[model samples]
Target: MDWDFLIDIFQQLLGGVPLTLQLSLLALVAGFILAVVIASAASSRYRLFRWIASAHIEIFRGTPLLVQVFLIYYGLGQIPGLRQSVLWPFLREPYWCAILALALNTSAYTAEIIRGAIQAVPASEIEAGRACGMSGLLLRRRVTWPIASIEQGQQGRCNSAVP
Candidate 1:
């Protein structure tokens, strides 16, 4: 084996690290943001929100990632006016298409994790918070999520886990 040949191959692979990191980091951030919205909708009191969130999760999780990648990367151009729209520039790029596909794909799984965490919170804790006159966002912020977040931890349960 030639040492110089192996080094050249390593150099070529290392050169792509920045682009790979950019793609993965951007996809994870975008996916998490979308996942939070989807989870909230899934846990909502309204039926319409739940339905939409469920559909999004089901469709994205049920379908193949390759199929989604192909659809977003290639199908968008098929739309009559999309090619002429402002988003066309970004949509036409392979990097953006891959990121979008990855984000949507990850969002479905992340949303389910978030939803499961929320559901894992005990009803007694929620009742305790409500008894303290906490409700709505305040209840969720100060009480619900903290307990839920720490529920799976080995430390048992904590009212405020992180902060």
Candidate 2:
């Protein structure tokens, strides 16, 4: 019966679409980049790197997004010297604060996704790549990464949907 009122509400929601998309794209791109580094460290031979990466994944993933958002948006403002820092301008903006929070939160989940994808590649395949003289970055680029990335793409698409 209240078609006009419903239309007005829908129009109001539509006005936020641009900002929502902008926030999502920026956060996703940033989160993916961070995820790669984190996943690499998580897979590293070195214990310290592994520990750091594990801790990061746990802490970020374990905490609630709302708590993280509150910490970044409100907590950042409480830092004394932050006002004088070069990051002050960006940190002070609500948009940037939201982006940072989203990026950090998403990066943890993305890291886990990437780690699983990389692990899903068979060990024999890695050995074969080594046998073929594919080493280090080259092996990763041609073999492990190519295979794993397929999984990553699929999983990422699924994971990106909001709950």
Candidate 3:
């Protein structure tokens, strides 16, 4: 109801924009790296690799992110081994803890995006690669991976823009 109050609040909120921007950009970069690892693991011929990747994605995605942040910060501090470790100095700071949680949260969603995109690539294209004597690294590099890369980039941009 009060225009002056709204403007004052907005101006105050503007001061935090730098921290918000840093967090978002850092999460995006870290999530992109995690997505690549998840995609590779999901596509691997080894069953164990696939299982590990899927489990990691599901566990992170299923939990509430705020709790994850708390757990990483407070929970880690409670552990004697972790508290005494060299990593404790970094993890003891709440800023790094928040960033870690944000990165993991974004990574889980990105993993799903990459998995779906890779699956959307046509099996026929893979067969064609074999027909053309393109197998292993050559086939994946030239055909399968390129198509999936395009889909990942397109979907990632679209999804990140929405929120």
lDDT of each: 0.93, 0.94, 0.87
lDDT of 1 by residue, 25-130 (tens): 9999999999999999999999999999999999999999999999999999899799989999999999999999999999999999889888889898899999
Candidate 1 vs candidate 2, lDDT winner: 2
Q: For model 3, what is the error of residue 55's alpha carbon versus the real structure, in angstroms, after optimal superposition?
A: 1.3
Off by over 4 Å in 1: 152-163
lDDT of 3 by residue, 21-70 (tens): 99889888998898779878987899999998888789889999988998
The residue-by-residue lDDT of candidate 2 on 75-104, one tens digit each, is: 999998998899999999999999999999
Superposed Cα deviation of residue 131, candidate 2 (Å): 1.0
Question: Could you give the candidate ranking by lDDT, starting with the highest?
Answer: 2, 1, 3
The pairs that clash in candidate 3 are none
My TM-score estimates for the predictions, one after another, are 0.88, 0.88, 0.84
The positional error of residue 6 in candidate 1, measured at the CA in angstroms, is 2.9
